[model samples]
Target: MPLSPKPDLSIIVPLLNEQTELPDLFQTLADQKDILFELLLCDGGSTDTTRQIAVELGGENSFTTQLLDTPPGRGRQMNAGAAVARADMLLFLHADSRFEAPDTLSIALQYLTSRQSVSTHPVAARFRLHFRRRTTHPSLAFYFYEAKACLSSEDCIRGDQGYMLSRSCFEDIGRFDDSLPFLEDLRLAKTIARQGSWLLLPVRITTSARRFETEGLLRRQIVNAVIVNAVAVGWNEFFRELPGLYRCHTETGKLLLFPLLDGIRILLASFTPDQRRTFWQATGRHVAANSWQIFFWLDARHAFHSSLPPESVRLQWTNRFNRYCAPFVCSSPVAWVASAAVRLWHRAMLLLCRRLEPVTKTS
Candidate 1:
């Protein structure tokens, strides 16, 4: 068939080693739910069967899928795919992500022609994720997150939430930063945010929770936190020196962190919602628990300090944690005074300790 005039939209999906999930993903697209659009799938080198699966799904002459070879890195692959898009709108989609509504492209096209997009930062749209559960229904928070994902703009996005951007908008913000290994989504968002209002439509897109299921929510959350914190400080710099940050250096650290996290989970279980409300009302935001597993820290006077013995450390820490968290819990001026006092005490002790300990010469 001869090439036609450029399509209205191109769904650019970047894939790498997604063999386990790629087929179902393509099948969703193959439904021709959005016939007016083109599918541009860019595959990075996959040691797994992902590329083969994609080829099979798309078939030799499938008018829908356009498979291309691109380098690894989600941002890099997406940028490469977007560059070749013949459509006026370029939607960056993940291989595992699925649209909850029918004709995803049809819904997105409506946004493209609208004047509402012009004044928006980065000028974008995204749908929410609805994970396919084989045995059970979706979780409470999952639905909430999915609901929020649809309406939140770049400032309020998670990477996996599907992004629909105009080709003009993509070019206006410059392409995704190919150099970033992680947190590339936020970098793209920041760039786009500088240009126009970050907009999230009410439409939802369902995506697999496989990453969290495979990696565990707590572990992934910690990793995400480290990445976000690192990006916030500066792009592409190591912040592993921060004790709370997670690093992939060793399985050994995870072994230790797991028990500490378990302790935290168990303690949280002990609180009734009403009791938790009372505790939270009494203590406030600064009431917390994270440093317990760090082997290097041992300051009793520190904010993280607990005089309770090692055997009772976990239990005691929980009590202290619930005690100090205030503003949301109590919202009292007394708590504010107490919070100020703690900060002053901490600063004074640090200064006093430094002055008292004479500097020693180092060879």
Candidate 2:
């Protein structure tokens, strides 16, 4: 494939240890011979021979390929690739992402071209996304996320969908925030939402769900919800701490318990409102019985503190306790009893505390 005098789009893939996935990714891009685009593979210091393979694949495919080196961060890598890119449009892709159909790039270009012809302002586009190799009957979590993205219009977007933006728009939105440890994609989407309109293309892209599989899908979703809420609520400290917490949990093999915990969450979620209320009361009793152990662990963990924001702390502790309590709650018939007992104890305790409150005296 010969290079065009001026490529219409520049495809930048930021990669790290993507040796196994690079072949399929590059092959997918190379198959789109009709799409005028330049391929830029920005390597984030991969110890594997990904760089060498990228070079070989580029030569075999005969597309304009430029291999770039950058520090190991997705934002920095993409920015580095974009700095040297020559196309008027930039499409950022993850190594494991693939076009859902052969016409994806062409359709994307048509949208951009049509938008540019009519509008004076810069335009951006993102494709609909689905997890690759999903079952015919996907999980509830899958539907939950996909529906949320579509319903949201443009407020939320997963990076795997691929972000296509004109050079002007990319610069105007201030580009991707490199300093963020993660969620740079969503951050960019939020910025784009504020700056201009987002073109939600009907075309879809398939992204790898390896992480969700390795870590329980539901647990990952819950974690994502907590982090997204943290970002929404301006609790930046909690957001910053999440990476460390994830690392700690992974090293300790705590992630193995996520599937079980998530299963219990699903089971509890399936209950009717009235049934849930009854279960919660039982859960309270169970908690009260283990109050001493809970207190000891909290003391050891230094979980109670006045300095940290109360809401943030509460959110973290609630999730942590749920993980530990899920196993007990999964036992036959015990969860119902625990929830009822716990609810009753909680009400009594609240009533006593309210009764003991001091009254103000007027002069």
Candidate 3:
């Protein structure tokens, strides 16, 4: 089959041992209408028949499909896929995700181009996620996951959210951090958010929750929360402890320790001058977002699991917190000092980044 000079999108999937999952993914991609796309499967040394299944699926489909080989690891496989992708836009999807709508790609591209027209910089986005199966009646864990995706904040976009971005913007951010064994996608989202708007599209991509089921839903959420926090704090050491800490019997996983926190200490003192400068910039960006989030969260259960207006819910909660904390937490001298210190740190990082920007640009 002849290929376009540039496809509208290149869907990159990093496959390991997903023989059974390939056909459904390929079929779903095949069903996409009114859009041009190339599906590139980066096989990471699959011992199963995943490669054979992929090849057969490609032969059966009208769309362009390629089964490429790579070293075992999602980061390496995705980077390898990106290296050869022939599209101006790229989407890194997991093997277990599938587009339920026939026009999902077309709709997603329209959303991207529409947003791009209004923004001065490149736009990246991800679909809201839906689990393929519900494990029991319903769990608060599911609601929390849904809320995290729906939140207007860019930081909440996770790997399973179906990342989509133009190739140029992707390249500018230097692509995914292939160095990490995990949380590469989360880190990539942060980098993209820094550059421009990171959108969470209303369109939903259903993904397998088999891992959550196997690992235990609550336990998986705990593990995820830990891993995400570790990435944010750049605590490489904590991550080393994760695979074992959360290792399921088939499953299982804080703040205020910053001075002693391995990640924070490394950021402040252990890094080289250049590394420290990068850390400072990242720190400033992070703290600004983090500080807002401290106030953004509401204590009410309805705030997280409701169909009510998000702002209205947040505003009411904020009023309640201010009324309560003002007479207690904020009244104490120790509390005042701690709060002021945090505020000062955020301001200091901002000014430091401003001072360093010129030197970084010229260098």
Best by TM-score: 3
Residue 159 accuracy (lDDT) in model 1: 64
Off by over 4 Å in 1: 60-62, 116-122, 147-153, 239-363
Quote the lDDT for 243 in model 3. Answer: 37
How would you order the candidates by lDDT, starting with the best? 3, 2, 1
What would the per-residue lDDT of candidate 3 be over residues 1-363, giving only the tens digit for each residue? Answer: 775557889999998778878888888888899998899999977778988898888999878888898986678889999999999889999988988899888998899878977888868989877777655464445645655566656667888878899888889888888776666787787788777778877577888877777655754554464456557657575555333343322222111111112233343465678765554444444434344334445432466566543223444554564565534542335344544565475456445545543322210
Residue pairs that clash (backbone atoms under 3 angstroms), model 3 = 248-251
Candidate 1, residues 1-363: lDDT per residue as tens digits? 988666777888887777877777776666545556778888877777877787787784355677889887788888888888998887888877776556665766686458454564457766545666543653543443443344333544766777777888888878787776445677887776666656555455667765556555555755564355335534232432233333222222321233323332344356688754443333322221222212112222222243332112233343444455422333455445544554454356445534654433211
Scored against the true structure, residue 335 in model 1 reaches a CA lDDT of 48
lDDT of 2 by residue, 1-363 (tens): 774578889999998878889999987887774678899999988878899999888888767888999987789999999999999899999999888577789988888778877876667788776676545654444533443344334545768879998888899889889876567898898888777767777777778777676666755655664455445534454534334434312233323333323333444566689866655654444444443334333432332233321112233443465577645654646655655654465456445534553322211
Give candidate 1's total backbone clashes. Answer: 18
TM-score of each: 0.64, 0.66, 0.71
Ten contiguous residues minimizing lDDT sum, candidate 3: 251-260
Q: Is candidate 2 or candidate 3 better by TM-score?
A: 3
